[model samples]
Target: MTEEKGSMLQSVIHPTAIIDPQAKIGPNVKIGPYAVIGPNVTIGEGTEIMSHVTIDGWTTIGEYCRFFPCASIGSEPQDLKFTGEKSFVIIGDRSIFREYVTVSRATGEGEETRIGNDCLFQASTHIAHNCIVGNNVIMSNCAGLAGHVIVEDRVVIGGIAGVHQFVKLGRNCMIGGLAKVVQDIPPFVIADGQPARCVGLNSVGLSRAGVSEEVRRELKKAFRLLYRSGLNLRQAIAEMEQELDSSEEVEHFLRFLRNADRGICRGTKE
Candidate 1:
């Protein structure tokens, strides 16, 4: 080992911690007892790994991230087709993983599971292989995301919710507790129940995100056209383009609706 690899700063790591010599640990990082850091792991400045946490594989963790006890990150994928191919898990800054949260690496070679900044994953949350999670997202306790899910910014996933693989959740959307999400959820919506049906707009979420009243009203109009007008997807898009005033928010909504590959979630009564 080179002198740099052999001379890791040991002040913050507990005596029982086992960090590979090749692991790159930045300044002010704190590692607690019995934590295992793999050779290919890179932890950024001010990150904290608590007791019994295991960070393995080719993982890159950003600055100020915190992992509570028993959290496991960058583990091999659980897919049956995994054949020991190299993959990665990349996380952004200031995220928190609560006790027993697990983030798995992607299945294909050179692929990665990526998470954005300022996300909070509560206890026992599971992010399966190849998921892409956006910034400021919140996953309540026991929420589980299947492989290949795409979660956009500022979304809230309630406790015990289970998202199906390949589903896309749009920005600022909210999913209620125990929801079983099987399809795409459009932007700024609220969905709940088994099989996850859309119920209403996420007014509170939009307000918290500093969306203006004018934009919110336009969004409401768009929502009515999409859900209550009894129009199909293409027809609703046409109506929105023709009737609703142009705004960045409304245009994003139309684009999301247009690109809903797995199909958008249906209305509650539909």
Candidate 2:
């Protein structure tokens, strides 16, 4: 057990719980039976760690979060070369880690694994180390993240999807269940299949989200250049640059495509 020195440690711990005296627990927090809070753990105000859960080292969780039964957070990265570096898991407020969800600590020394606010991780989901997860994301049951993946805001990942390491899923993207996501998924699209392909734009989603019609038209045109024109990527991007004026949404899409380390999912099969 490490030393705890903070305004935390003022929280309520169940009598049945085994929290290290060294762990820093915040105000109005609850710890359930047989829950083990290891050293260097800092749980924020109004959070709850349920029964049989284990929160390990160097973990920092924000306020109003909930961890269900058997959820394991801040465990060491599963990467083979990890020699117990001082990696951290930083979680923001109002997030839910459901039953059996496991979020590993960072893989690089002194590096941080980050999860933004209002995200939901359903049962048995695994977020590997060094992953950057943005706000309002929902990952369904049995969805797993490999090391260093980046998931942008407002994305909904379907059940049992396996995201490849370093793959990035752009904002507002939807992936179908059981898909093997080996490439990057750009923003505002629906991707599905064994090897994922961009099936169509997420029109219904955008409509429900209250996106403007003009923006939708711009996105539609952009999509046409990228997916429907049959032009190669460079040619398509060049054409889009020539034809479409810069808008925030278009710029985001272009930047996503430009910065793709793992290539974007194609509209058609090879």
Candidate 3:
């Protein structure tokens, strides 16, 4: 049940599958029984679409990805103001989506929902319209991200967490299970609770990501200055700039703090 085409093999599509004639399926892909691929969809090479999966709208999926059964991708956004304008969902390579995961396309015309490489989305996860997810991110079961949220690289969202709309989760951060994240989360921190306050630095995640020990110490100092010193936000930032050695990590941390519009999560008073 295989067909060779040029340097790559054509897909093995089940007889029960329904693929639109204009859909573009890449080499070595597999579409299982009862799967439906809509006209504007493009699936990349070696990707697998399992049974009952529905890939609709103007979606572009990257190579070697796996879509589990009952996953629905690139559907129209849930926004009530959406007027059926054309939009897209673009997913990167090697991403794995488990059963019943749903990803919505953008709401505005010509806008796109973007996901980066090597992400793992567990069962029942929902990524709302126009979300930007960076590489190596992991979303555990039932985690939901609202519209226009930004998730940076290597962020791990625990099961049953819900991130509010317009929130930005920075790189290497971890959100504990059942958290309700309403504000921006800066990089290298661990946040949890009903409103998801920062509890400590994400030492384990930073260590696994190979962040240098010197940088870690500097980050610790910066965190203490920002949270423990009782200084206001502006004062803490100014002090950090003046006191800390200018490393890449320090610069990035400061930059994130400066750019935060929803205000960064606060730490619990010890």
Per-model TM-score on C-alpha atoms? 0.96, 0.94, 0.97
Q: Please list the residue runs of candidate 2 whose C-alpha ends up more than 4 Å from where it truly belongs after superposition.
A: 1-10
Worst 10 residues of 2 by lDDT: 1-10
Which scores higher on TM-score, 2 or 3? 3
Ranking 1 against 2 by TM-score, winner: 1
Encode model 2's per-residue lDDT on 196-224: one tens digit a residue.
88988888877876777888888888888
| Candidate 1 local lDDT, 141-203, one digit each (tens) | 999999999999999999999999999999999999999999999999999999899999999
lDDT of 3 at 126: 98
Give per-residue lDDT, candidate 2, residue 90: 95
For all predictions, the C-alpha RMSD in Å is 2.5, 2.9, 1.6
**Regions of model 1 farther than 4 Å from truth:** 1-7
Q: Model 3 scores what on Cα lDDT?
A: 0.93
How many clashes does each candidate structure show, in the order listed? Answer: 0, 0, 0
Q: What value of lDDT does candidate 1 attain over all alpha carbons?
A: 0.94
Per-residue lDDT of model 3, residues 1-270, tens digit only: 345354335788888888887888899999988999999999999999999999999999999999999999999999997899999999999999999999999999999999999999999999999999999999999999999999999999999999999999988999999999999999899999999989999999999999999999999998898878998889999999999988888898899999998998998863
